[model samples]
Target: MTITRRFPATLLALTLATPWSAWADRVYSDAQLHYVNFVQETDGMDALFRAMDEGNIHDVAIMGLGVAKKWEESAPKAPRYYMGDEAPVYYYSATDALLADAILERPAAQQARLHPFIAGFNPTDMNAVNHIRLMLDMHPGLWKGIGEILTRHDDLTALTKGETARANHPALMKVYELAAAENLPVILHSNITSKRERAPIYLEELVEAVGKNPDTTFIWAHAGTSAEIHRYQERVSGLHDIVSTLLAEHDNLYIDLSWTVLEPYLLDEGEPDEEWVALVKAYPGRFMIGSDLVGRFDSLASTIRSFDAFLNALPEDVADGVARTNMLALLPE
Candidate 1:
């Protein structure tokens, strides 16, 4: 028998209420929470810790420094022009030393258990690979994995002067090899298509990367879409099919359910979709949730709240795995 669960109306109402402390207590107080997609910022470590404390988010996989001012300045601005007046330009300062410094700055008791992802925009360059290795050497026990590597990212590529490095590019493959040797997973963002169409156009590159490096685990960030992309494009019906196929074929692949990218497909009228439910049940161990909060401390509570229903619909063990355990298993011991 297929069991279904729904988020209660009262809980939903409470989740939207301000002074998020109340919502946090109601939903997350007793839950063992671990957020997998925290983007590191030059500032805001203190505030991030404060929010994490309130939400009971104990551990985080923080991506590298996000502000690449030089690349942002040199890249074309056409892609973001459509974003309108309030479209803020995003920046990253994701370096190993900076991330280490940020974590160390936090008081010992307040610091969320940290798992760092070394960020790389262009992994095709040998220098980038060398830099990653050097970072690992310098910060002996700091890094847990490699990436949120902007592979096949259309918006970021435009902003970084059109550096369209695919997931299986030689340089990235070498990095994957290094990660495998070190027993670390690599999180990557490779969108399914550049056009607004619902097609898995560049999936082969991602598949090849996974196939060639069977030893290294790969976490597909946002299941290949972001809130911004979802806003502009029609929902892609084929996404679930692609994900299902990949999960069955690749033992090493995992999906990061982050932000609002997969919301429509995961839910119908605020309830879990039967098809999505079955898909998750079939591959229970392969999916994890992430806030994908890019240095926005205040958004943590709301981001976890957004996925409340989807997580609730899963089988109990599966929900727990996605909520905390799977990510914990992937982190460096």
Candidate 2:
């Protein structure tokens, strides 16, 4: 029962007529749409699709549980510090099980392009491993990957009494082992350090996980970005060297070049960093771009377009790989 929505004629005509730079042309097309990392709600799928259509993105790896509750009802109960009175916040519970069901229930055409990742939240929860196994058992083919699994997440850890999940915890190791056995990629969001000093305190857990599980492919979400880290800290010095070292050491590791978090490291004074360019060229297949859009669709095009400069700086083949090809390659066969 999949439905394939054809691109609108006007959009198609525009896509063909626009003389985008050679790099831009390589990243998008009618037959080939850029892949995105999606955090979508069940009620908002149509809007997401529309946004994707507008952005010329046909495929998405849906992350999180997909917006379970309304923001007002789910807002933090404590009187937390606030910088702005009107800062936007969303509260939703998206489980991997729910996301898998949503994708499976889509029309056949849509299902073909939507890949769902299983969620394994709360490593301390005794049932976390069993819960993930149950979901995988129930829907054998519905999910293609695992995570945006929260490890050392500041906001989430705050909600859980400051108990940060560790990548190599016994419970998480079980889950990672399962992912490897299933041949599915695992997307992990493990911040490198808890403090704003860019000390790389908690990075060893990630390195250990990758080193231990050579069979499993791990996509380091946001390339170890933390919004809270950025808000308090100055730029992380030698970030590129650290990342390049990780890539060189681990064949199983990949980076999610999502928005805002990676913007600083990728560019230097609004220009592409030559060192970053060389690193990417050396391992062209190791990067993928994601809008990291949650529940909202308006910024879709702008987010994807933001990477144009970064993409333009790379060799055509490597740029294409980062922009779209690598994501497709990671999908379940």
Q: After superposition, how far is residue 216 of candidate 1 from its true place, in Å?
A: 0.5
Question: What lDDT tens digits, residue by residue, belong to model 1 across residues 1-333?
Answer: 111111245653443232323333422321111222222233367776777666666567776533243423444552213132223334343455666666666655444356667773356575567877877786776677887787676655554433457888888888998989998888888887664655678889899999999999999887876555566675665788889999999999998877654477888788988888899899887887777665556767666667778878876567666765577667655
lDDT by residue for model 2 over 1-333, one digit each (tens)? 333332345764453343334434444311111122222333356766777777767667765531122223445552222221222323223456455555666677677656677763556555566777777687766777877676776655444432457887777788788888888898887888774556888889999989999999999987776677777775555768889999989999998878744467787677887888888899888888887665566777777877778889997677767776687677666
288, model 2: CA deviation in Å?
0.7
In order of appearance, the predictions have TM-scores of 0.80, 0.80
User: What local distance difference test score does each model get?
Assistant: 0.66, 0.66
> Candidate 1: lDDT over CA atoms?
0.66
RMSD per candidate (Å) reads 9.5, 6.5
Report clash pairs, candidate 2.
1-107, 1-108, 2-107, 2-108, 2-109, 3-109, 65-94, 65-95, 66-94, 68-93
Instruction: Give candidate 1 misplaced runs (Cα > 4 Å).
Output: 1-43, 65-67, 70-94, 109-112
